[model samples]
Target: MPVSQQRPLTFFGVAFAFLATMLGTTLPTPLYPLYQTQFGFSQLIITVIFAAYAVGVIAALLVTGRWSDQLGRRPILLGGLFAAMISDAVFLQADGLGAMLAGRVLSGLSAGVFTGTATVAVMELAPSYLKRHAALAATAANMGGLGLGPVVAGLCSRYLPDPLWLPYLLHLGLAGLAMLAIWQAPETVTRPERIRLRLQRLSVPTEVRAVFVPAAIAGFAGFSVLGFFTATAPAFMGRIMDVSNLLAIGVVAGLPFFASTVGQLAQERVPLSYRLPLGCVILLLGVVAIGAGIALASLTWFVCGAVVAGIGQGIAFRAGLGEVVAASPLTRRAEVTSSFFVVAYVAISLPVVGIGVTARLIGLQATGEIFAALVALLVLMALVLLRRQRRPVMP
Candidate 1:
């Protein structure tokens, strides 16, 4: 099809594709226990495997994060879908640790490509009148997709024929459809006659530093809450609370993401000055609740904590993204956005590994309590910093 003649892609279409790829990233969440049983791995190994996804994400973000800006959004989106397909294939064929690691890394690569590019694409494609609505759609797609993965996998695991195999197969099919839709979708970036791709170093420019620093820190803390949930919540449920049902675990694990979506939607009403710091305060409460849940051995408290954290994360992450995007020059949007994600992913990856190693030594309950306390402290500090800094004007 000719470039201009191609059917225009709606915001929803782009958001759906984004959702599918993100969904694939977390589809294995509920299946972690099954993998542990089949492969005979320790809790520490499980976290290490999970962190492999983060490694791939950081690698891709550092290298090709700006490619979409130069090459065009359509190609990067398609590439992400293809990477997700490959990741799904690896999971379907996975029989051991190596396969699992390879699959997660591929999934991370897909996510890294999609994260910033898709968000930008959705915003660009939306009708100017609906820009705010488009932003919410993109946020929902990113976080909501993540939230759905575990639920889908958990249900499939509980009621379907093959728990591990079926979830990936379903995602593979969705990914294929997403690819087809995006292939027909219009490209938003103007193509240069000659493309020059280069490895972009990761750095936040001085102009954006004021907004980026606090926003990134808030992102890190918000994702830390998510990291703890996706990586360790299931184990906590099974090992500590004696809740062995995959479906239940999936719902609990998925709650934060769903709540995050709600929080993002609610951000439209919140004043800019209050959004970041208030979010941190909410996050602090959520983490404290999680600690109480762990210390008291109450599933109710844990689930409550997940919901509260999700809300806080959603609000803070959206505000941070908005601030970064608004503050960035048009030409550097992809790179700046990716930098924001780098901080967030680091929060997601490292803390889980810390918890994993610590869990092995001090026991899961104690480790969780300690992790929660530390995260709470981080959030408190972020809140203080955000409160002191001059608020950036929203575009």
Candidate 2:
């Protein structure tokens, strides 16, 4: 128990659990084409299936987001891993569209539970010397796991024996291991003997609204870019550009998330006041590049844009989150953090779903270009709002 309670070990252990859960969520990303092919569904159904994940996430955040503050961190973390395990099992046994939808929603629930809980848990568990660096560690695990899922799943499906079954099989094994590892980690929250569970009603304190609003706005726009890459980019590669190799598609599509992970390294050195606005500027450039790529049918431009936008998203994500978390009261930290993610995941779901629908009407290429343009416009708006402030947003 004493060994299990060691700060670094517990910190890393929970972070690994966070990574493992997220990895499962994205495992289906590169494989979506296969599922469409196997299930004989249209592209619209694919996007809807992906959007279902956000619905589940929003629901979980609204319902159980605060439970971690009431219950201990370890149990909530374990619950999320268990949900991921079930999601993997659903995918393993999936036979039709309904099953696929179910799996995605379950995957979203797992992610929703972990995103805020694990972020705070790892930060809380970090030793004093590493406190400032803990946010990078936590956020990197998230983006890193997201980046790895497609590559790992793509590889297993491409080279390994079974395409659909093998990736989930490997993840299931990892989830099991993650559960055991997390069980040994110490709980960061002090638990009450009589714990009462209630739904989390989302609210930002009057004082935090200033920082929270701008941060959420940046997150919403940046995450919309990520949503496009995660949900529609693969289809664009295969259908529009004629890139058919699952490995190539996965590698290309996963580039933004990988870039975001790298961006976190640099954000650690950036000043708190400068991070959000600077990130917004970079994100705008990246989205515009992506728009041009779609208009010109150039994959290189798309990839370039992805890297740029990812870096901006990473910087904004860490900066916004650091400011919000630091400002939140100790009792409500998880709730506010969960609320921030609610906005981020909403960006992930709704805009991409709109793209999916719009693609059916106007076509994928045009829809992607329009989406990029709109995201760039949104970023500009956020920057304008940030510029209007007389006092610096962050202290």
Candidate 1 TM-score to native: 0.93
Backbone clash count for every predicted candidate, in the order shown = 0, 0
Q: Candidate 2, which segments miss by more than 4 Å at Cα?
A: 4-7, 127-132, 205-210, 325-335, 391-395
Worst 10 residues of 2 by lDDT: 386-395
Give each model a TM-score. Answer: 0.93, 0.93
Give the C-alpha miss distance for residue 100 in model 2, angstroms. Answer: 0.8
Q: What is the C-alpha lDDT of each candidate?
A: 0.87, 0.85
Question: Of the candidates shown, which would achieve the greatest lDDT relative to the real structure?
Answer: 1
Pairs that collide in candidate 2 are none
Q: Residues 177-269, candidate 2: write the lDDT tens digits.
A: 889878887777887888889988677888888778888988999999888888887898888888778887778768889888877678768
Model 1, 339-377: lDDT tens digits are: 788899999899999998998898999999999988887
Candidate 1 pairs with clashing backbones: none
